[model samples]
Target: MLPVTVEHAAQTPSIFLESAYFNFVLKAVYHATKTVLAFLQRDSVLYWPFLISTLAIAWLAWRVGSAAPDPGTKSSWRAFSRSHLSRELWWHPSARLDYRFYVINGVVFPLLAAPFLFGEQVVANILNSLSTTAPGLAAAGTSTGVVITLVFTVVFFVAYDLGRFLAHSLLHDVGILWEFHKVHHSAEVLTPMTTFRAHPVDLLVMAWGGALVTGLATWLFHRFVHSGITFYTFLGLHVMIWVFSLIGNLRHSQVWLSYGKTLNYWLISPAHHQLHHSAEPRHHGCNRGFELAIWDRMYGTLCVPTDVPGRLQFGLGDDTDGRWRSVGRLYLWPFRLLAKRVQGALQARRA
Candidate 1:
């Protein structure tokens, strides 16, 4: 009996190691790692390769074109790079927490939500309904001409930018939603990876909004014109790839790249985004557009960048409670406060 029991115990570890649950965990970890790496590609703001190249080019151009002395005594470029492109921000404890949230939001949650969202089916149904009511809308899927495709491409770009602008503005204006969005503004230092330092809730909201806009635009184009063509691509990326390669990463960096007041009316500059992260109350709801400043200008939310760069501080003001800086607290405290608010409402209703 003793020998039999000993044999069974010895086999237990092997059994557990080979179990389905263990394999599932391993698979999840592998996929999460892959997703994180993919997002860190040069095209992405989270990575430094493209950003560093862009900075170097800009620095050389500035040195040759401008008469201003180098930005500092020793090496202004070195100081600028260290402050904004530091590995400290990349491997920071807070950034690790953000990466975990990115995995859950970008991969896990989407998989879980697929059944409920039925995004493909929803878009298909909407297209079908529109086609039935408006026959011209169905014409978009018929043609494969270059001219038609170019028009659709422009339409999609405009629609996407508009949708993002609306969603960003709402996140700032809505008090309850701002609680989740504030997680992003809590950053003390700005790095390219700081772009990913968003709460899962905020990510979900932005994604849904973008999806809806893109879906609607596609349907409209298929109904009226034709599907878009990608003619100008860099490494199979859209034409907009150059935008990211050139200036997107700078938006979240310490570097100030102003488009001037006139150009800023049409386009968003790096300095404009930095102002968005400014701790000042006046800047709180300004410059909400993602790619273009057209929406902000139309909606009266545009705050043009100045020639003189302001001394700006980031993060929520007066976070003396410390919850804003702590990852665990940031994730949990908001939900708890929400729950209490719900409970209070229920009690008041009953009374």
Candidate 2:
């Protein structure tokens, strides 16, 4: 239901990096230099930016949480409101149920996934190459290797996020995909807990797409640029996304403030993303940018209504099949819909 705009209206920034297939060797040099520099400096440069950004982001979270109106009471005359430390979140039966899954989907899955990605073979290949490459890269400088990895990681994240933003936008715009996406928007109230209340199938699809995009970016960056990989450096790719999620926990709270309404296009603000969660037709799929708003702006999916009342509701319309109201139902509903569709198609052809 996102507002349809003219094509080419969103002239997203053109990707300026050198060709992916041919730039592998130069990227290796960048990686080697960055790794050496990071080791020598103990990642001060890396951690400082993260620390400062975290603090600034934390302040932003507090501000936004304070702004959310109380949805429990009609007196507030606003929508999607909750306290930063809403007792209801910690004790709400629905919240608790959602938390169990969040832990598995967010923290546990990430930890379990590391081993698979950083398995023996993957590590061995990178380590073997690094032994020889690091020595030469070290000669360049103390933090040269670190610098290389840092730059590569940033670029990788940009590409990965770009892909995610575009794909998610498509999911909302495409009728077939919207059926599943609607499950996510079906939340009646906004809370930190609501952030993780996505259908498991939706989570799986998102996780897989993210992993695929990151992996492809990493492998291409390492093989062609730095000649190898450094796991932490590679991890730095999604560092912003992780931070965004950590901060995003605050976005749905009653507090609300937006810094980069225009600039944060690179890093989506809570206010910016909130609009997307709105069930209203115009708001739907509007703020499709995940970690960054740039893709939305560039692709014309950006929706910033400076004048409209805040999103009044956060779920699907009356047509929701109450059967999928529970956590288990949300997960299984997609498959059931698909099955019904397939059956209908087969019967129609036979008839």
Candidate 3:
């Protein structure tokens, strides 16, 4: 592996800028549209299965049940689409900031993780030591077939979800972290793109932490149990592809698709996530799980929604001072806050 030297790190920013500007920015509008479509159709939170299912259920409910279309709207479909895809929200300057940051993540996060990628060797060494001390662990490194591979896939998904749940909780509980996390919550409207509105700092931290957990789990599974059992991936992603294609995109959508009282205890619905984004003080820090509600249930953070969805106002409320509304401030202001925090800490120490 190549060493991550000062010269390499220095060159990364320029490399990223050149690649991002020429390769990314030049085609950003196209990519951004593609990205939004993908979110709506396949990946991230919104998947086609979930979308079709929600639409089908909503249509049925409108035709047969008390759930009716909004009074001013032409139909239920139009009302639902208008609520989630209003031009003001989709074309908001803030949404553009999200696309820009998405491009930045594509370029920057890999460079940031490059140095730490070498730590895999250290983890391998530790696994070797453990295997040497525990002969049973040596069996873990042995090659295995389809059954064990399936088991490993289950373990991988659980570990990934656990990491996401922890990182999300910390983002809410920690002040400095919340400063960065607030960017996602600052969106006044809910769109699939709002899912990408994450601040880079928040994204990087969660990405690194989640990657570490996943890498370590993978190493342990391969080292101790079955080396041949790898991720059960579809389109190069783990089970999340199914999750996204099923009901994941709905998590960030205005659609109110709940798994109901009993099922919600097992699976998190789109309504569960929309409730999490609710600006109500009661909803703050309520549902933190990414793909599962079991974590929230385990941690006493779960709040099941009613059969009827409630109206929600999204955003961070008055604490933002409107600074979060600007793309420039969204990128720069977090660093400024961090600097002030460091200076204050230094002064307190001296006193």
Candidate 4:
């Protein structure tokens, strides 16, 4: 104790360092395994894992409010109006309305746009250019491209979300674009699926607009800068897609998660998005970036007021309950607005 040897202390630190290194390796291996498991869960036989994870998340949410019967406060074992926070979209009364739009916007519009977006002539032109430059790429064959295309399809979905944010900001700020896109924000209820609950025409325009801009940008990036997409492009995109989906859902939830401005770059964080959906004019163009805050920052449309709470209401100025809120009405509302504008213009000319 009086004279501790350097060798004795060195032995402990060496052992401790070795132990820490082992723990780091173990954690790394565990995370790698988890990622692989997640990728595998997309297969047919892996449905059980997917189902289990979904149930687990649902159970986790339930557990937060699953208290035993209380003594004094009035409550019923057979509850009718459960807390809004506890209920999923399917259980919500207006959920069907939301899904109705989603089917039309996410599924229908995408399919409709595919012909125009990936037309044979367009495809041939694109492939011919790539084939001319990278002749070896053709040898990979249709199967390789098909497999690659399957992966790109997921990227396109992610890209659409990013596009929607920009398109949304434009809808509010730009004059004519708003005429077409206003139909999306016209919704009374904001839900996770609300992102997909867009007017078919608006959906088509925004999807194509963003796709065109993004595809061209990506082509330039791959063609000029990198000569091809980097692994990080795919990895970063995949990570951001999952993150945006998770955060986007919260933006729709009644309960708020305010990240202020710190994590806004990493996430389109729910709190800022809520500000965008606000009925307040000040928050009209807030949180414009879909996946990256950089877009909002670059365009100077980002809004995050420190003094006021992010919680705000949503509903287009012309909204009428059970009227223009239906899926059919959503599609027709723009046309009606257009017709009204035309009539007013004619009257003004006569006057």
Which predicted model would earn the best TM-score?
Answer: 1
Q: Note the residue pairs that clash in candidate 1.
A: 136-223, 137-223, 138-223, 140-222, 140-225
For residues 116-179, could you state the per-residue lDDT of candidate 3 as single tens digits? 4433335545666766656545555556677887887788787777877888888988878887
Which rank order by lDDT, best down to worst?
A: 3, 1, 2, 4
**TM-score for each predicted model, relative to the true structure:** 0.77, 0.60, 0.74, 0.59
The C-alpha stretches of model 1 lying farther than 4 A from their native spots are 1-23, 39-43, 47-49, 57-76, 82-125, 129-141, 227-234, 318-322, 340-351
Better of 2 and 4 by lDDT: 2
Query: Model 4 — which ten-residue stretch has the worst lDDT?
Result: 65-74
Q: Write the per-residue lDDT of candidate 2 for residues 261-297, one digit (tens) a residue.
A: 3565555666666777666777766777766777777
CA lDDT, every model vs. true structure: 0.66, 0.55, 0.69, 0.53
Q: Arrange candidates by TM-score, highest first: which order?
A: 1, 3, 2, 4
2 or 4: which has the higher TM-score? 2
Residue by residue across 47-136, what tens digits does model 1's lDDT show? 555656667744653454221234442246565455445687666665566665566555565444545453423674577686685546
Candidate 2 at 189: error in angstroms? 1.4
- The clash numbers for all candidates, in the given order, read 5, 34, 5, 0
Better candidate by TM-score, 2 or 3: 3
lDDT value, residue 17 of candidate 1: 71
Worst 10 residues of 3 by lDDT: 60-69
Against the correct fold, how does model 4 do in TM-score? 0.59
lDDT of 3 at 53: 64
